[model samples]
Target: MPVNVYRNESLVQMETYEAEPARVDELVEQVRAKWSLLREHGYAGDYPIEVLRGNRNGGNIKVVEVFRWKSVQDRINAQTDPDYVALAGQISSLTTAEGTKETYTQAVRGFNHNFPSVGGVELLKGVCSCLLTIDGVVKDYQMSVKNGIVLMHRSPRMDLDGDGRNEMYLKILMHGGEIIQAALGPIRVEQNFNRPNDGIVKSNSAGGSDFPGTAIWRVSWKIHTPMGPVLTDPDQPLIFGPATVNHYPPVGTHFHSPTGPVALVHEETGARVGTLTPGELTAFDIVVTKDDEIYADVLNTPPADIFEVMEEWRNRMGDQEVQPVVAGATDGVM
Candidate 1:
């Protein structure tokens, strides 16, 4: 009997196989060889888009194949093709378990900076902001063009504290100034644009009687549970330094979390700005300056809970006896 094949509207198909520990390598090679035949017979489009292999429990091996097909029908047809039948039969002999296939629709896909492209170029523009809160005071700063040049760099998502969850960071340079840096996370549901710049710090030089340029930074975050916004150290600035005349010192801030140290980076250029050296500092060393200096305000409430807020609004409207309009009613007549 012919093997069962799944069908869907998507152009992508994923096939997972389980094999014996000793035969895992052989199974992978056979699959790779079968891909060539499938492409030649037009049963499959191109080669597999992604291939992953790993060891599971009981010394078994798992191989996952992500194939990008020319169309959904092409994938369906390939499963029953004589060439595929023979190929699958050979691969099955090496496995101790049945294979599973799943199909998924592509939402969005893009290459990173290091990937080779036609123009040999990469996208280097991104946004970074900082949230400063101290003594129950809040302030924000965003990277912008200064002297016709942007002065910020954004780094790729990294687990600086080795917390498993990835975090993106931003770095910027400013004239002598002071501001509190708050722990923040992403506010938007689709974090493709705005990301969490957790554990980033800034530094400045010393100047004589000059109002040093304050680096206003802000980030957004939400709790996993339904706990409301909670500020832990409201009276502490992550880092603070004095102003310098005609000279901007390489004064940088660093934080030593329980897991490890985290550093800051440039928002636009993605270059390492300062090192996050392991050190000792008390909460009293931090300070909160002014709330009036904040540039923009970002709410920390999660968008996932918008339904609850809307329900409350609906209740208020019901209490007010707001009438619903009839369909096709004229203005002010319903």
Candidate 2:
């Protein structure tokens, strides 16, 4: 009797073999359940599926990797336990550790007295045009600005195709640091260039007059909130009082800082729309990639909105339902 099969690409079946061995292990478990349903929804991390068994050129398959790449510290420890509490509400009630290093030195000298200084042609046109054309080279870089994004730090070179260039190094902390975070420890670089994708050139910034199609460009100042001014130039109009440049919302919103993590937004329904109370904890949007770079987590930070960092991780046990997942999980819809 005949026997051939072939699936997804048609031919269904045409069997006849009768050599027992439990019917050839139930026909190799129905061809591994149709190749795991054509590798769960048909090919993505494309090409990589072996399973041979000698005969033709000494075969012996078992390869497997139709998609697999999760490192950046395994995606930043996938949200390192302890209900994360907005990353442990990065507070400083001055409980210990020298009051958490004197409350992180008065929260970095009162947030760098209104941190906003990356000029000098946006940091030398972001280190010679987006770190030598997308991380070809750029000796150990670093920068900071917490809870408002802008954190490049972590770096290394040669992207050997780990996407994220080399590994977890969050960029889009841009001001002229053209979309980096291309490499670090375990590999990353998934669709980088979160901004400045329109012509990308700075030749040291063409004297700012929109040369080369609006020359000297680079984004991610969180693009000025509200989804960064409706994703930059969504037909302009992001008017936020008092010479807006990052002092955010409905006119300064009375010095936004609900005791700890900042809050307030209505920049076109990213929601949370308002909050300076209940020990604030908003996150309508905040892009920072590394800890295994993925991007697009959105919501899941609720372990008590952060009461003293979930009481210091529930006094070191963590769990009152423990939450905070969504570090942009990019793999089979997280």
Instruction: Please name the candidate that would achieve the greatest lDDT relative to the true structure.
Output: 1
lDDT of each: 0.37, 0.22
Candidate 2: list runs displaced more than 4 Å.
Answer: 1-153, 157-263, 268-273, 276-334
TM-score of each: 0.31, 0.18
Whole-model lDDT, model 2: 0.22
RMSD of 2: 26.6
Q: How would you encode candidate 2's per-residue C-alpha lDDT over 1-334 as one tens digit per residue? A: 1111211212111222222232334434443443344335332122233333212243322211112212224324434533332322331111112111110111111111121212111111111111111122222122112222223332222121222211111122333222323332221111124432111111112232211110111121122321222122222211111111121111111111112112333245654322111111121221222332432232111122122332333344332222211212221111
Please give the lDDT score at residue 70 for candidate 2: 28
lDDT string, candidate 1, 158-208, tens digits: 333443332223332211112122333322211111332222211222322
| TM-score for predicted model 1 compared with the true structure | 0.31
